[model samples]
Target: MYWSLITGMALAGAVTALPRLDSRQGNGQVKYAGVNIAGFDFGCATNGNCNITAAYPPLQSLGGPDGAGQMQHFARDDGMNMLGGTLDQTNTGKYDQLVQACLATGAYCVIDIHNYARWDNQIIGQGGPSNEQFVSLWTQLASKYASQQKIVFGIMNEPHDVPDINKWADTVQAVVTAIRGVAKSQMILIPGNDWTSAQQFPTKSGPALLKVKNPDGSTDGLIFDVHKYLDSDNSGTHTECVTDNISSAFSPLADWLRANKRQAINSETGGGNTASCQKYLCQQIQFLNQNSDVYLGYIGWSAGAFDPRTYELSEVPSRNGNSWTDSSLVKACLARKAS
Candidate 1:
C-alpha cells in the first residue's frame, strides 16, 4: 500500500511537470512543471497587474532607534529575538499566505532565506559564521517546508568573501542532502560564489553535482543555480553592458549544462529601483527569455527589504509614503513569458 501511494504521487507529479514557454509556436506563455506559471514575486504585495507598490509589513527593528548599522551583522539580542519570533510566526502561516498570494498573481513563490550571516562581511571582505552553522540552518529550513510544492528554495542569497570552491561545494551538498530528506521534489537552487556571479561557475575544475550519501549509499536531485548581473565591474548604466555581461557569463554555463546534461536556473538579479538601471534590467529579462534553456527562471533581487534606509526598492519611503510598483523593469519581467 505504501509503495502504491508513493507510485501514485510520482506519477501525478510527473504528469504536471513544469511546462516550457515556446514563443515560436504561439504567444509567449510560461509553463511550470508542464503547466503555465504565473510569474510575479509574492513579496511585491501588488494585486494583479496593478501599478501600485504596497508597503512591507512593519518588522520590529533589529537595530536600535537609529537603524545605523547592518541589522544582520550584530546578532544583537533584539535582532535575534526578532528573527526567532518572525520565523516562528511566519514560517507556518506566512509561508502559506505568501505562496497563495504568488499563485494568485500568476507566479510561483520562490522563497529566499535572504540572509545567512555571511552576507554582511562578504560585501566588504569580512568573514561570517562557520560553515557548520550554515548547514544547521539549512537543515532546519528544509525540514520546515519539506512538503510544499509551490516553494522553490534558494540556498543562499549571495556567497561573497568566500573564494574556496571546495568548501562551497561541501556546503552545497550538506544543504541539498538535508533538504532532500524532507522535500524531495522541491527545486533546490545552488548559487555560485561571490553573489552567484556566472563568472565564478566552476568552468575548468569544480564539483559538477553536489552529492551526498543517502542511507543506501546513493545520491539524487541537485540543480545548479547561477545569477547574472550585467555589470560585473558595477560600472555603467547601459542596457548593452547588462546584456553583454549576461551573454558573456551565461553563455559558458549554458553550454556547459547542455554538454553535461545538467539543469540550471538564473535565480536572482536586478539592481535597485532606479531610473538609470531600468533598461539594464529589461535587457536582462529579454536575454534570459532568449536563452531559457540555460537560464531556467529568475527572481528579482527583491520585492522589498526589511531595512528601508538602505535596501529600499520602491521610490516612496517604506515607512511613510506609498511606492509605485509599475516600474519599466518590473513590468518587463512580469510580462516576460517563456520564449
Candidate 2:
C-alpha cells in the first residue's frame, strides 16, 4: 500500500522540478548545504566509491574467529579501527585525506564519528566516551578544518535506544561549545536524538537550540542535521527511498525548519541502489535544486560498506569484480549547482 503511495507521488512530481527557497534574498547568510557521505567509521575506511573491499578487505566480513583475524589484518594494513584508536580530535591527517577526496569531487564531506558504548549494539546512545571525549574530538576537527568553506562538522551520527533527551542535549552542547572554541565561522551540523528522526525533532524533549556566544554576539553558522529514510522506523534509505519521500514525505522537516528559523540538511541517506531506486535518488537531486531553503544539503550513507546490497554508490563490489561506479547516482548527485 505504501509502495503504491510512493509510486504515485514519484510519478506526480516527475514532470516538475522540486521547490526552491530564495537563499540569496535572505540576510546574506549563505547556508552551508551539501551531501553527508561517510568514508570512515572508527577504523573502516572506504575509498572514493564508498566500498570497504576497495580499501580494506579483511574487515569486510565481520564473521567470527575468522572475522577477528581479518580485522587484525585490516588493522595492520589500514592503521587501526576507529573505535580502538586514540580519540585524538587533533589528528587531522586521516580527516584531511577524506576531506580532500570529497572536495576534489566537488562535493561536501561529512565526517561521522560512529560511537557506541553499551552492552547491546542496539544501544546507539549507551556507549561512547564521556562528554570530554567528544569535546576533544570536535576541538581538533573544528580547529583543523574550520577555515575550509566547504567543510561542515556533523557532531555525531545516530543516537538510538537512549531514553534521556536532556542528557543527549547536554552532550551535544558540550561538543558544540568545544567546536565553537576553534571553528567559530564553520557551520556545525546537529542531529536530533533517536537516530535523527524528523518526528523526534518536534516532539523530543531536549535543548531545542544550541546557543553559542560568538565574539560579535550574533548567531553565525549553525545548522540542524536531519537524517531521513522511508524504510520502517526511518532506519535509513538509499537514493530510491529519498525519491519516494520527496512528494508527500518532505513536509515534516521542511515545516520544522521554517518554524524554527533554522537550516536543515540530510547528513546521511543512502542504501542499496537499484534501478527504480536510482531514479528515485535522482529525484532528490531535483528536489534539492528546487527547495534550497528547507533542504540545505545532503550526504550519502557511505563511501564504503561490506554489503553491496546497502550501497548507494561504490568504486568496486564487495562480492566480486569491479562494479566501479554507479554513473546514474553520481550523475544525479553532481548535477545540481550549489544554490
Global lDDT scores for all candidate models? 0.40, 0.43
- Per-residue CA lDDT of candidate 2, range 1-339, in tens? 000000000000010122244433233212332222222342321111122232221122322112222222222322211111113343344334444544444333444454421222333233445677657766776776777655556665555556666667666777777777776656555766666654566556223544433345444556676665644445553333434466544555555556655566665554445566456655654565455666655544433323445443431112213222233443344222311
Report model 1's TM-score to 2 decimal places. Answer: 0.60
Task: Give the best candidate by TM-score.
Answer: 2
Off by over 4 Å in 2: 1-39, 42-92, 103-107, 116-128, 205-207, 210-218, 237-243, 246-249, 304-325, 332-334, 337-339
Candidate 1 residue lDDT tens string, 193-281: 65556656657223533343333443333456565555435322223233445556665765666565455655545554555456666
Which candidate comes out best when scored by lDDT? 2
Alpha carbon lDDT of residue 112, candidate 2? 47
